[model samples]
Target: MVFWITLDPLSDLSRPPGDLSSGDLLNQVLYVALYCLTMAKLIDLGWRGARPLLHPAYLLLLAWFAVSAVLGVNPGTSVRRLVLCAMVMSIVGVLPILPRTQRDLELWLGTAAMIVVVLCYLAVLLVPALSVHQADAPREAGLAGDWRGIYDHKSTAGPMMIVFLFIGAFLAGQGRHLFGGVLFVLSLVFLLFTGTKQPTALMPVILLVSRLALRTRSRLLFLALCLGALALYNLMTVGSAVIPSVSDIVAKLISDPTFTNRTGIWNFAIDRFLERPLTGYGFMGFWSTDAVLQSDPLGQLAWTAEATDSHNSYLDLALTTGFPGLCLALWVVVLMPLLDFMRARLDPTKRGLALLFFRIWLFCIFVAALETVFFLRDSAVWVSFLIAIFGLRYLACYPVRP
Candidate 1:
């Protein structure tokens, strides 16, 4: 459902959002049906052990989203987006239990992710206009000729390929040599053409940390490191804009330390967030709404007003959902997921599955520091992150039955 909705929902890629109106409605119906099935299956399975979805974190976040929606700038837009988010979250609630065992999980993930890869590759080959970014794109015009491959932008496609790349690795470990080799090579080749530097660079970092995590007795240190890395990155990019001193320090290192003008957007976001640090502009309100997007900031960066997001999920959350919501998000997204990975790693048999989810969870959280990824409306990375969190939570508590 995720692959189909993200990749094949639109008939016309040129103007996808409007063209996907009917498709979105259809997908929503499908979501409702699948959600029912997932709930029924959970009931049939005794619902006790399969209680990953019942975590307080998820509930609290949902409640916060609801509250933010009501108090947000555009209540109507917030409500619509919140409904869609609920449907997606509900459907993914049962993904961890869908597979009977670890082997079956590998098979399902391999086949599904490969199908997405093949469709992306075929689009790039047959309809370059649709699959690849053109020189004339409205945003990120410099990204022309990069491969987006049935996605709205190369940024989205790059992370999806990385997810597939790991599925390929898992398949290889499971003795599906031919499938694994082809999937890995193809995913790697496609990822390179996307020209997304962060994902490409972070892959190795995630792998290295995962290796350390498995061998070490403490996952807490690694968690601290993760937080540290994000902190340093924020300090470099947005922090520079917030403090003149930080910008002075970063300027000594890089010629354009603003990370291609991301700090300008961050600065504007920070200014607004300070105005209403408690309640925020509301869900889907800060950046996407017409009032905010069209409004002119006379002394601020003009481009920042027209920007899509704060370019930092942490800051974006604070801007839209307030500081408390952001803190709740940190608990839900960052801490518990890693702790789940740590617990799941105790069993040697569950090692591979645990690591897979660990890697996926790790990548998303790190990526979140740079990108606006938390609840970004069915984004591929956001969907995969939820899947990883659920997978780890389930694995930590229950065994994969043969």
Candidate 2:
């Protein structure tokens, strides 16, 4: 888990002894190591221990992705992505069988968070060239300086810090006050250095809402309130004219009149999504295809030509796998865990895991609006999300004492 979370082999600062090709070779080796370890652990669990792994929603989602990949515009690439997804999910499948108690879970979470925080600080202080983004590459408007802090990009580092911040809070709630407080402060410092505006602005609100939702009468009511709030926000922001003051405030906070030029990318992606409404371009298929690069469908848009993704997970999923894919994702990734957490809420012994899953689910859902995290291979956010979903399923199948 630490190996995957740290992504050591993929880090620019930790390149292989030789050239770029050797680095790719090392990455492949590490991936194999990850896959073998996951499978071996699953085998050790035996059929009885692994029975919970047969989650209906998870299986159905993987099946749908398989079929979509088979019929996708880029079958080879889609299949590769599907395999990687399965590998990550396989590792996640072990979560339930591990962690015998809430303390066990907390220990793991705190350890991982500390490791990340320490590594980030080390990179910033000791290896500035690799940790920070250089001026050679064009940056977002208003981002005079940005630090990635051991991550490949500021965008990646910022979201990661946001996640660790929550993890730190979780530790504090678990009674590890000193460790949690230190992690919280460190994560905030790294987030500020990254200069990631939207996430920094949204983190406090997300944490507050998650805490409030946990106190609701039932999961159904919580879900309803969440959906209602989301709808209200959407209605208000659908057009600046609907609520000019609110929109203006948001724009100024992010300091990006065009959302860091995301609007143009979203528009182009939506147009492409319309082109293949059913079983869209395929998983990670739209951006790299020869046809797309040759035709330049986005025209002279400044950001679109150089962009690698839609920037919005929902739109990216829809563009890659269409509405059906999007529906499956929301069901398996979001709604299923939510439902499971709700069911677990009925059991006093299961409430801890339930709350943990709920908080992680809320964070993922919120971040997806601004980042491409859905099913993204090897992303810390996506991996953390899988942990939440799989952890919820684990508790549902094998109820644990709080």
Candidate 3:
């Protein structure tokens, strides 16, 4: 949690010649702790008890990632990424084993989230130089050049606050009314100051839909809604290219037709992906590579040299691991767990857990369209999604009746 909040803070802290970033170092330590705990649990449970704890689809997904990394363009970097991937999955795998009850899990997570939120507030109040974006710094649309509130960029802060908003909602539902309400309001204020347009606009609608989904308690309904939304998004994306009116209207609405110049980045990424359709350039390969920089796909665009990611998670994954990796990811990271969540009986006692996971999954799906989040190393969003996926699986298999 501390690591999540302090994402690579620019401190005068000294380190060895070849040390990892503070965030990565902390993540590795957490991974080691989780590994030890998981191994201990496995030993105590024995093979029969542990067998059910393993999710076959997740294991298969891990295997595919390993294979892709081994065969990837940058073998050294891919191998390192593969290690991080395994560590992340291991952390998620042990979640069910670590928590004694749903309440216990909720309490632990809620408390931790609250602590992070409080720390963010303190950083913003005490150290504005480090926490807020500078006037001359790049600003996103709708921010009016205000504070980012404890994150390096407005982009990062916006998404983090969004996560905290839902976490606050969950805490409130769990009867931590005052604490949760305060956190939610503070998160909203911070989000507003960051000036993030999409997430800020979408929050209310997402919350409303989540409430409806929980009330319906029908997995098919949720799935149908998701499919419909995805279809609509695709249509808009396609229409932007084929229909001038659609493009004009979107441009008028957002005040930037190219989605703040993301289209150029996406186009470059697409071309790069086509070059290596079967196996991509490798994990974190394309953006920083000399070949990509030399090609200069963006031409005279302002952000050409500054862009780090494709901005779309799907595109990023395709660029990193190609079609095979993308397909495996869709199946294991998304489809399988979605199917499981839908099929699992949502008893009264499990409804809260079900709804929490459902909300997180839905949020992840929506956010992926605009952000490069899937399988990102040391990312809060990715970690949150893994928790949701594994937590739902645990609840489904165990079927705790309160």
Candidate 4:
């Protein structure tokens, strides 16, 4: 778990360029070291409580990484990501082992909630305060809007918090008594302040779905009314002269067109794929030297300077690691959660929690359609979520409450 917490330093690019003459190699070494340490600790622990690590998803992820390494254009880069994945897999592996009781679950959740509180504050208030730019198209996004965050980008952090929001909302719903309400409220506020589109859209949808899922008779009707009211609010605000900011943002959304030109990038990447159609330009290698090989006919794209990721995880996987890596990555994400769905339903009480977590995870996947390539990055947080689902699955199989 400690490895999981700090494994990110391996991927951290914020280190001063002069401090580390060579950035990439240092990051690679750090990742490898972290992986070794975590594996050694897990082995020393006798694998007594290490169940999740042995799961199908964990094994598949490792295998995918191995394949990626063998096929990777930059074996070193692939290796670093592989090592980071191993650390995260270890954390998930340890989840079922460490917190075996409700008290433990509550304690862990409380600690996580506290961390979110601090992180959210940093993200919202402190980061915004540190902002130096104000223009819509400034030289840099500034602290106020890094687009990416302390980790990778808002794309990652935003979806990550949505997962936490689901967890908090679930616990709060499960009768956490007094503290639950506070957690739920904080989760909502944090979700809003994050300002990512998916959370903004899905939060209300989750609340509505949760109310229905809980079987609160008539509550569904109330939700419908509330939704109507929300529609009315949007309708009234859409053109009202009183709210210029809202109008400006809406106009921007409308005018920007086709999701900020994601279609163009997708088309360009696909055409490049058609060129090689088989191996492509070696994993993560194209964007560096051979990006021109990509098909960006529109010339309205950024294939060089700001073209680090493809936004779509599947597309990025295909482009970087080819079809084989793409298949494995998708399988690990989709199959694991779907498998847990049954275990979740086995116990009606925990079904909602299971569903909420699943929804949040899927929401990330959905948002990935237009944002970051999460699997390529240090996905410790998402991996934690997968571990949590595994834990709940075990709880379903071996009942404790009854």
For lDDT, the strongest prediction is 1
Clash pairs, candidate 1, are none
| lDDT (Cα, tens digit) per residue for candidate 4, span 1-402 | 332233442222332223111246755576567657756776876665455446675576567556656565556655555555565555455555455565567657656765655555554455543221223333334434443333334444556556656666666666765566666666556555555675567556656654453453453463454345434433323222234665566557665433554555666666565665444445454554334533444555554445655655566667766676666666666545545544565566566556665555545554555654445434545564555556545554555442
Worst 10 residues of 1 by lDDT: 14-23
lDDT of candidate 3 over 9-67, digit per residue (tens): 53311221222211256656766776677777767765454454466766766666666
User: What's the TM-score of each model vs. the native?
Assistant: 0.91, 0.87, 0.85, 0.70
User: Under the 3 Å rule for N, CA and C atoms, how many clashes does model 4 have?
Assistant: 2
Query: Residue 107 deviation, candidate 3, in Å?
Result: 1.3
After superposition on all C-alphas, the RMSD of every candidate to the true structure, in Å, is: 2.8, 4.0, 4.1, 8.2
- Candidate 2 lDDT, tens digit per residue, 213-311? 767876668888676665554333333323567668667755554565566666677777888888888777666554365447456665444566777
Give residue 255's error in model 4 in angstroms: 6.2
Can you tell me which runs of candidate 1 are displaced by over 4 Å?
A: 1-27, 44-46, 293-305
Runs in model 4 lying further than 4 Å from the true structure: 1-45, 55-61, 122-152, 206-257, 276-302, 348-353, 379-381, 388-402
Clashes within 3 Å, all models in order = 0, 0, 1, 2
Report the CA-based lDDT of candidate 4 relative to the real structure.
0.53
Query: Number of the top candidate by TM-score?
Result: 1
lDDT of each: 0.78, 0.71, 0.68, 0.53
| lDDT of the structure predicted as candidate 3 | 0.68
